[model samples]
Target: MNKVLLQWALFSFMFGLALSLPLAAIHYQKNSSFKGIFTNYRKLKSAHLDYFMQALSAAFVYLIGFAAHIEFAAYILIPFIFGVILNPTILLLEATPYIRSGWIRFIYRCLRATSPASLLFAWLAIAFLFLPTYMTIILLAVILISGIGILTFLIKRRSRNEVGVKITEIE
Candidate 1:
């Protein structure tokens, strides 16, 4: 298995394990003061889960690549690592009130928006690296279709927002 990928998996797992202490404390209301640190329990729980899932995903990819005798480049692994780390981190930040508005919220949204693309690219790159040509083609087609759908949704949402702004300006 790729050492880097394995390391990331281990890191994610350990981080999740560490995070669970505070989560459990908050869940059981062990310390009322501790609960004040994280106002949103649900987001904290989600972040905890995301970390575990991301760890599993990293491990799964590493195992599959090892079994296929496919060696992944370090650069190709960047997106996966970025997504796995930042995705849960964003959730963790959301658990606090600091991410509610201003530049922090904008940055949070930017990170959130980019995470799906990073994950998709990482997985698709892995598929292309190991899978047969026919399977890779099929996967590429599906990804393209999904990308188009997401692009369309984003465009529509932007246009609606623009229209709303214009209407408010005219009033």
Candidate 2:
């Protein structure tokens, strides 16, 4: 039963990650233009609101899952802390490139180079709201696949980056 659940969760995570990736990249790149990818200021406001809402919704779901599993706080905390650590680097990776340079940017860029690390961060966030071990494994696999998609997407964007791509980061 646990294995079945695990497999099902894996499938769910993969499906969601696969579907979300392209759309997100498209939306993000389009939004990168400060005009802001909306018809007007009103739409831009709504768009940002939507992003926040989606993030919140995901968080709520994760918390509920953690509630279900109810593990020792530390077990959940450690990965989450790592996730937190990775997350800012991701934000910095995404945001820093827009400005600044030198060692900090380079360092952030290198850390940002960790493809699935972002996906792992998401999985860590969801880990708290987990079920049995099978569910956890499935979540991890989803994270794994998400990492794959990140590298795949990045390579597709710039062929030069393809040379250093890692094995585990591939789909």
Candidate 3:
């Protein structure tokens, strides 16, 4: 098979495994049951962890595709991962109310739970898979700059929420 297709398969097989963790966590944590097919929530949870490792391995294999060039890798990975990203975003938002630690805990849980870095790395892998000429400096700049901006916004929001918590403690 060609590089992109090969990598896609690897990603689906292995990275798909690791991909299961955050998805499974969100699912099990949100729902007490998985339509009763699992019969045990613990099994459901363990299965998520299992998928997570597989996904990671798949991603590693997929990165090899970055060494070559493909016409539409970026568009492909983006659409492919859209639901993957959304699933956790929605799940985390749902758990915010139930989470006990407030903003800090919420942020921490999200950072741990969603795995944005992995997503970015997937993009980087996309970069690698494509021809080096196709991966422009501009694209790298955009990714890094956007990451910083988003990180800054999150930190500020969390700190602002924290001040309210401090005031409550004083009172």
Candidate 4:
């Protein structure tokens, strides 16, 4: 088992468990004052869920790598660790009122943009390490196609938005 991944998994799980305390407090308590502690309840909930998901993903990666006898390099594992930790943290920060503008907001936007790409690269790298060559090629092709499709959809949506064209108008 990779010690780094295992340690991060444990940390993420413990952090997630810790977050449940405040979540439960806000959930069960009827006091509006207490509920006001978090500005965005939805984002807080998303952060809580994401933490647990990241924990599980890290553990799964660790277990699979162990079973496959694949030793992951620092480059591969660094991105995975960074993404797992930062993704939920971004949501957690967004739930608060502190990061609204200025340099902090700029930094937050950069992190938000980077986290997904890091995780994608880490997962693809790990998959290539463990899976057979043919499967890796297939996986890469699927990912590329899916990315292109999503990009096309987003581009069309953006153009529609710029033209002030509503979905109802199109229909």
Question: Which stretches of model 2 miss by more than 4 angstroms?
Answer: 1-62, 69-75, 81-93, 96-100, 114-129, 132-171
Model 1 stretches with alpha carbons more than 4 Å out: 101-110, 147-171
Residues 1-171, candidate 3: write the lDDT tens digits.
234444444443454366355557556587634333334444444444434443454454445544433334554455335423333433334333333466756665665555555555655665555536545677778879999999999999999999999999999
TM-score list, all predictions: 0.77, 0.33, 0.34, 0.84
* Model 4 lowest lDDT segment of ten: 29-38
In angstroms, the error of model 3 at 168 is 1.4
Whole-model alpha-carbon lDDT for candidate 1: 0.86
RMSD of 2: 13.3
Which candidate ranks first by TM-score, i.e. highest? 4
In angstroms, give how far residue 123 of model 4 lies from its true place: 0.6
lDDT of 4 by residue, 49-116 (tens): 89999999999999988887877899899999999998898998788776787887887898889988
Candidate 1 per-residue lDDT over residues 63-161, each given as its tens digit: 887887877786578888988888888888889787888998888999989887798788878777778999988987987999999999999999999
- What lDDT tens digits, residue by residue, belong to model 2 across residues 12-76? 34444453443455456675444322234333333334334334433554456455664334444
Alpha-carbon error at 161 in model 2, in Å?
14
Candidate 1 clashing pairs? Answer: none
The clash number for model 1 is 0
lDDT of each: 0.86, 0.47, 0.51, 0.86
Return the lDDT, model 3, position 58.
42
